[model samples]
Target: MQDQPLDASDFELIEDTLLKYGDDHSVLNASELDGYFTALVSSPVQVDIAEWFPAIWGGQNPDWQSPDEGKQFIELSVRHINALATQLAMHAQAFKPRFEQTEHHAQPLTLAEEWCFGYLRGVAVGNWPELPTPLAAQLQAIAFCAEQDNFEPPADLDVAQHRQQIEAIEAAAHALHDHWVAQR
Candidate 1:
């Protein structure tokens, strides 16, 4: 498990594996999966991949013919999250959150919505205590992301506006991580 950034190939592999063996899990997209991982690692309460994996897989056992490959995936995922968490904790300003795709896609907002939903679910699954004011505000913003479903971008929100919203979400993520780290 190296502290390497997950590249596009890694995302493709993860998405393909989830499609094959996630037992119809909702986190099929890279953004949602990344968000879930980030939340798990940044959570105030401890969470293990062993428990989280089953939950993400919809409580169904992974149907991996090669268990070693599954293990590798889990290890890589944990390492990836650890790297992100470290970056967030050490250099918050330098931290650039990775979304699902690079170029503009048709489902950017929808993907963002799913990512927020996954992130919130991760927080809920943890043994989280009462959140601080900043963290709570961040949660509220993420909740707003979860509620968005319109395919058409709002007239007021152009591409730049949408990107700003995502930047805010990324900032909130870093803020939540900082809050939890300070608690420690």
Candidate 2:
């Protein structure tokens, strides 16, 4: 599948879709954004990761067989997703509309980018029983940013590389968000 060339139409369609999913707010906050993600990802699809048994992969998902193991594994997954979303939402394409439409200096994120990130973060916070609405939303937003930048799921992703990419996006977003926040 990888060896096959990407069709132009397929690529273009995904790219267009990514453009539509950027932040609704010109200047978004983490908590609020996390809430947004939680709302989106709190559906049944997210609840049934690997058929509600993430350990199905020969215990590849952190050996989470026991109740406590499952709980911890889920929590860690959620946190990582939130981080990915945050990175996804921070790209230049996501903030382009904001920059052009408003006075903010932020960049733009495309539809596919926003969708991927939002989806990740949304899924992340959706499973957290203890996650406050605000904190969950913020984390979700962070996840959104990360996902947009090509975040892969744990079982399917390259952990070390993905983490580095997510971290870099987060650092850049933090700087940009801080600057805009200070203006208010």
Candidate 3:
């Protein structure tokens, strides 16, 4: 049987725990973690958990109040990662990125920056090699979101434009996963 998927409560617990223990450098929320796992799952090569787990804490493991707490966190993380992999492989186009939405300049915008940053971090862990032109274009779509420092939205930036960019991120993720699946 397929492993049980994480529920809303599980995500709430994750969010709570992250807020309680995560530092400035650590992944601040479940959405970012989801993006991180998405990239890890879509990577051309398998990235070992040993190498990637600590990355969630920005290269240091979190100090849990109890061992059981840590166990629960690890279990949930593994389940999430597995679920993302399965979704990407079996329902590539149906995959939707876990992005947080917030208002910027009084206009609603999808905050993909954190998610994209997590994805880029995962890509770094995988030490991704040069890609073909087509795949590069897809990855570029994601990278554009991550380049927060270089991006400055104009005063007239429409919410539709932001939505379109977020949609491209989803498509890129699905395409990247499909490419790796075909390769493997």
Candidate 4:
């Protein structure tokens, strides 16, 4: 499948399967899974699939109805993971985080809460070492976006600035990846 590009249908299938079979602790959807894979690919040290795959299902394997179903999920996830690594390595400028928009206080808000949350989860699984202050600051943008309960405008900032923070997640991801690449 290396020659074949993953399409929207592949993501839809992954999201549908996760929703259908995943427990409450599973990553919420395809966007989040993409974020998770991004973090894994960008890690300074490699994380084994055996160590990280179970975390995708909330620390256990999903109760897939059939072995074929389980195999398909694995295949799709691996393909996506490889795609993320290749993109980060060779086409960083074109990288985009899969964010979603929703109505917040009757205004359209682009949110990356789920995606950032999944990324943090991957960071935890990767057991990333403490970063220097500058790099840590880049990661702070992602952490800020991941706050589910406090997704509102920061008390110190206006709506536009808050939206900008959300928008900065993609740049933050690229910076983080580049930092790790430089370290390697």
Residues 19-116, candidate 1, lDDT per residue (tens digit)?
Answer: 77764455666666777777887887668776777767766657778988888678767766777776776766766655544334444442367678
lDDT by residue (tens digit), candidate 2, 1-184: 2122223453343333223322332112232233233333333234445532232222233432367645643454355334433434344233211110111124221222333343344444344344446544545555655444432233444545644644544443444334333433
Instruction: Give one digit per residue, the lDDT tens place, for model 3 in 28-77.
Output: 88878888999899888899989999988889998789999999898998
- The TM-score values for the models, in the order shown, are 0.82, 0.22, 0.88, 0.89
What is the C-alpha lDDT profile of model 4 across 37-150, one tens digit per residue? 889988989999998899998999887789999999989988888878888888776677777777666777677888998899888888889989988988888887787733
Q: Between candidates 1 and 2, name the one with more favorable lDDT.
A: 1
RMSD of each: 3.1, 17.2, 2.4, 2.6
Per-model lDDT: 0.71, 0.37, 0.83, 0.83
- After superposition, which runs of candidate 1 have C-alpha atoms over 4 Å from their true positions? 101-111, 149-157
Collision pairs in model 1: none
Candidate 4 regions off by >4 Å?
3-5, 104-108, 149-159
Any idea what lDDT model 3 has?
Answer: 0.83
Deviation in angstroms for 157 in model 3?
1.9
Show model 2 residue runs off by greater than 4 Å. Answer: 1-156
Candidate 4 at residue 89, lDDT? 87
Say which prediction, candidate 2 or candidate 4, comes out ahead on lDDT.
4
lDDT for residue 59 in candidate 4, whole number 0-100? 93
